[model samples]
Target: MIRASNVVYSYLKYGRTGEEPVSVRALDHVDLEIERGSFISIIGHNGSGKSTLAKHFNGLLFPKEGTVWIDDLPTDGKGNLAQIRQKVCMVFQNPDNQIIGATVEEDIAFGLENMQVPTEQMQERIDRSLEAVGLTEKRNENPGCLSGGQKQKTAIAGAVAVSPQCLVLDEATAMLDPRARREVIRVARKLNEEEGITVILITHFMDEIIHSHRIFVMDHGVVVQSGTPKEIFADPGLLEQYHLELPPVTKLAFGLRQKGLPLELPVLEPEELLKQLLRIRKGGGAC
Candidate 1:
């Protein structure tokens, strides 16, 4: 489990004012608890602190005030930094920045090597990680030769090769094309569903939140609302306030509702919306 209690972080910047410091509060009195083996999505506008909060989960930045604990280990303590990082792994937006090894298998082995896994076990781990990401055949290939999606998958393989308890993706798909983005998301879903690894997905895309167990919406460094996708999508006004767009299907359902159609509050996917429309057309009971 991960917990943040009244966490606060500030950045000090220097201007041409004779060494004066300016502080910008990236996170402000934020509190949250993420359960084990659950998939959660964090969404917000630009500069809304979603990424800032993500950094805290991996101990990349300690809270200036209050506390952040990962599985009972305080992230602020210098002694626990290594342990905290090992438990929670992070993937960034750019695949280029994350890739280090020349080949896919070598990249997956990089993390395990740092932990000093035996040479005999390294090959097995490398093989397993590559298979997990559906890139076993590309193990011998260079990361530069793969497509954007493949590169991200390789990055994910590297992260999972370490066997972390929790995976924090900070807009991991932002740089990929639509097809590539879908591929990365599918891999993330498989990790959470098949491996039972907790997933913390930080993204601005509304479609990505549909599969999440819970959604947390942030604005101006504060958590404004959080709930299941159904509850969060029910209020179009709230989403507009945060400058967020609804999933395409949800928006279509909302438009139907405004036209005197008896549609449900939240229509997460196109299939769900289609089913609801069919039921309504057949004069079925309450949708």
Candidate 2:
């Protein structure tokens, strides 16, 4: 559903008092692709260009060089901008920053209003989106008055109300507590599984991405590794080189395997680790 080729983006850094503006490259020759109806994640440490690349998905920021295409439309084409944006919608890190309307229903309606969707169709979309996000009961509440997770769901509902084909969640769960983070992730997973919307989640939390079909690891503005979650986690040293780490359960499994416990290299969940231990116990192996 999305493709980028040799994409390069730079930010102009201005020095104090009339010095030359330095061109700092944020994305350097990055190339990646996302398939329709798949859940994928982009992970990196700070300054890794994850968010910069996401902006290209919806044309929030055009690449300084190369190209980004949503569906078959080039993002650089002025005439295609509108359609590209409609095809791909984004939910950023801060719900406070994204939420505009006072109430949940109104915030959702904001996007449809901007698109000039007919009144009947707009309400129908709003109700459907709210139900999808599990926020139907809170639709009348003020967004600010809701929990952080709820506010983010409102933001997601806003994006869904537009009927976007792809959802780019740029650090959408960064601010929430663990429970809230899981809530947000659950909503994203539901949307991907049931609605078949392509999901591109940009997050540093390794555990949050365990179920993703694919992962793109970025460093120094480049895609250093791209593979399934297990394939990426199987090499902890590679993640360390990029200032990333394995999920907690995987980390413990890695430590055990290193100490000659014969555990698996990358155990994604605690239950998986326990199952492996049970098998070892049945075989009379040391735990």
Candidate 3:
């Protein structure tokens, strides 16, 4: 659904007049492809350039040296800009920054209004979008009155109201508590599973990546590792080198393995760990 070829982007810091501008490279010759209808998570420490890559997916930032193509349309062209944005939408970290309208339904309809969606169909889309995010009851409520999780859901409803084919979430759960984070993630999973929207989620939390179909690990503005969550978590040395933590269950399994207990290499979830323990007991290998 999306492809980047040798893409490089730099930001110029302006100096006083007659002085040379300083250029800071944000993305350096990065190449990536996101399959249609797949859930992909990107993880990296701070300043790894993962967020920069997400912006390119929605034409928020065009590459200076290379090219970005969305559904076979070049992103840099003026004529293709609208189509590219329509195909991919972005949800940022702060709900306050994204929410605009006075009421929940109005905020959800903001995107469709910008797209010039017909007034007759706008109400239908707004209603359905609010329903999809489970915010229908709050349609007339002011967004500020909602909780953090509800605000995030409102942001998501706004994005989905346009019926975009892809969703890019850049640290969308960073500021929320654990409960709110899980709520946002559940909404994201539902969108991908039920709505068939391709999802590219960028986050620093290891637990969030456990359910992803695939993961891409970034380091110093480059993709150092890319694999399924199981493969990536199984290698402790690699995770340490990348400054990443293993999922809680995986860490427990690793600790058991260190004590001479035969355990699976990557126990991604609690249920998987429980099943492995049951098999071990049945095979007379119980610790």
Top-TM-score structure, candidate number: 2
User: Per-residue lDDT tens digits of candidate 3, residues 106-209?
Assistant: 88888999999999999999988888888999999999889988999999999999999999989999989999999999999999999999999999888888
* 15: Cα error in model 1, Å: 2.5
For all candidates, the clash counts are 0, 0, 0
Worst 10 residues of 1 by lDDT: 278-287
Error of 2 at 26 (Å): 0.9
Q: How well is each residue in 1-287 modelled by candidate 1, as lDDT tens digits? A: 99999999988978896988999999999999999899999999999999999999989999999899999998986799878878899999989988889898888888888888899988877888788889999999999889989999999999888888899999999999988888889989999999988999999888987999999999999998999999999888999999999998899889988887798778889989888888897996444
Residue 89's lDDT within candidate 3 is: 92
Q: RMSD of candidate 2 to the true fold?
A: 0.9
Judged by whole-model lDDT over C-alpha atoms, candidate 1 comes out at 0.90
Q: TM-score each candidate.
A: 0.96, 0.98, 0.95
lDDT of 2 by residue, 139-182 (tens): 88999999999999999999999999999999999999999999
Superposing all C-alpha atoms, what RMSD in Å does each candidate have to the true structure?
1.9, 0.9, 1.6
